[model samples]
Target: MGVRVIGPLDAAGLDVALAPFLNAQEPTAAPYVGALVDRGWVAPTDAGTYVLTQEGVETHAKLLERIQIQRAAVTAGLTDDDYRTLLDLLQRVSANVDAFASTLR
Candidate 1:
């Protein structure tokens, strides 16, 4: 992953924070925000905004690893099958992480 400089962000702030990298308008950003919440990267605050949790920080670190792997695969001219395999591996890993985290709660 190309190390993108990120700072604290909320749902409404994505356009500004991601301007240099992505043209993520609210239409696109909403689903991503929902997914982040769904995956435990973000929590809805009482103020009706979202904040990144400790789990979000940790999950982002893992996502960076996957980004790097995919970048390498693309650079090597790997086939779509290789990408699919990586996606499958990531899904299994996510399921395992979810299960393990559940045990602690």
Candidate 2:
């Protein structure tokens, strides 16, 4: 991921940015943003938003690359049919969980 990929830098924006890795709630990203600022990975702008520093961009790219590598390794022996079957099973399980959850609501 690059700075361009992240788009925004406010807490709300960060919530979206961190969603994939953290599955964080919208209000919870503030602490994560603060941590990023403290680490010099991001800088607060006069607009009260943040932007990725050069180091942040570099780090994000590295992390994304590493994830890609890991994903490839994990799926190395899986065929396309295997992937489709896995996806279908996961979707069915998710739907079942959602149905169960709705009952508790």
Minimum summed lDDT over a 10-residue window in model 1 is located at 19-28
Cα-based lDDT for every prediction? 0.72, 0.77
**Candidate RMSDs in order:** 12.7, 4.2
Q: In model 1, which residue pairs have backbone atoms overlapping below 3 Å?
A: none
Pick the TM-score winner. 2
Residue 35 CA error for candidate 1 (Å)? 3.2
Name the runs in model 2 displaced over 4 angstroms: 1-4, 16-27, 79-105
Clashing pairs in 2: none
What lDDT tens digits, residue by residue, belong to model 1 across residues 1-105?
A: 356645455666775565444431234466777898898888888766677789988877898899888888674875779778888898799778767887887
Candidate 1 stretches greater than 4 Å from native: 1-5, 18-28, 45-49, 77-105
lDDT of 2 by residue, 34-102 (tens): 898999998988887889899998998898899978977987899989978988998799778767886
lDDT score at residue 85, model 1, on the 0-100 scale:
89
